[model samples]
Target: MYSRFFSLMGGLAAILSVSGGFGLSDVHAAPRDRDDVFFRSVAGVWKGPGEIVAGKYKGTKFTCDLTGEPLDDKQTGIKLGGTCRVGVFSQPMSAVISQKGNSYEGKFLDGAGGKGLDITSGQVSGDKVVVGINRAKLNGAMVARVSNDNSMNITISVKVADQMIPVIGVTLARDIDQIAVGSIKP
Candidate 1:
């Protein structure tokens, strides 16, 4: 469960990398307005439950507590750090992403070389981000969708032969808010 979920997440394994948003080449120039805004919107503390929906780890459920921070305003990207807990075990997780040229580059944990995956490339379209991930002989994709300012859903999938299979699914909600607002009365 840990290996697969982390591998899947070790994920942002690409999504977070894409969100933390990083680049292989030297990041130059400025990012698009939407890109800038996207990263900023994801900046905050997030927590939620996740499940390994497929493979041998099917039915495995866990939870993660993560915090996201937007990069410098000049750059379009984000960085995420936190821990994922499963039963009595816990793992430290981190991801970084940046925009280089027209694409994005980043990595999860220490990248594919260590215990996490690498963010090869990514693109942000409206409320969601799709990132390419790779680790040794395995190749996959992570998609993160921001349903609203306070919610996000992440899905991680690996390429099997000629198919992309979903392996992990996570739903995150912001845990902290700068200010509380009054509700409207009907």
Candidate 2:
């Protein structure tokens, strides 16, 4: 069951570009063996796959991506994707996050033009990442690692709905494999 759940969470991370955002470690600019960062900066593009862990769609497939500009030194943009079951959902997601600071705050767009989902509690450490609603019921986490060769491995635990049931376990290494930093010039 844990293996199945982890697989699903890893898929969700891909669908969500779960690795894209601000607040990246100083490791971004530091002289680490890896030369680039996936989620920081003005314009960046990443592609990965995610899975469905609940409902009829459990263990399904989806494609996720992020595109946006830098505001107030923060990352802001549209995160939208395709679900094998559902056609499309667009989230106006933004993260005014600080990596070394241990906290992040942002909102998820409900659709193309509805209200946004408030992300009130967000935090990340070297290996753990979490986000949730303010006083409501919603949360998700990813335990991640990046090797010197620019490979990232992440595991996720999510608080599903009002039940707060942690549905997924630690995920195995799903390659969010590559990142295209800066603009996507047409």
Give RMSD (Å) of candidate 1 vs. truth.
6.5
Compose the digit string of candidate 2's lDDT tens values, residues 1-186.
333332333234332444433334455454221112433322344434445555544654544444333333333222333221223543223333222333444444341123334444454334334555332333454444443222234444456554443333222222334344578778
- The TM-score that candidate 1 achieves is 0.83
Error of 2 at 173 (Å): 12
The whole-model lDDT of each prediction reads 0.73, 0.37
By summed lDDT, the worst window of 10 consecutive residues in model 2 runs over: 33-42
Residue 35 shift from truth in candidate 1, angstroms: 0.1
- Compose the digit string of candidate 1's lDDT tens values, residues 150-180: 6678888889999999988888777756434
Segments in model 1 whose C-alpha atoms lie over 4 Å from true places: 13-31, 177-186
Against the hidden true structure, what lDDT does model 2 obtain?
A: 0.37
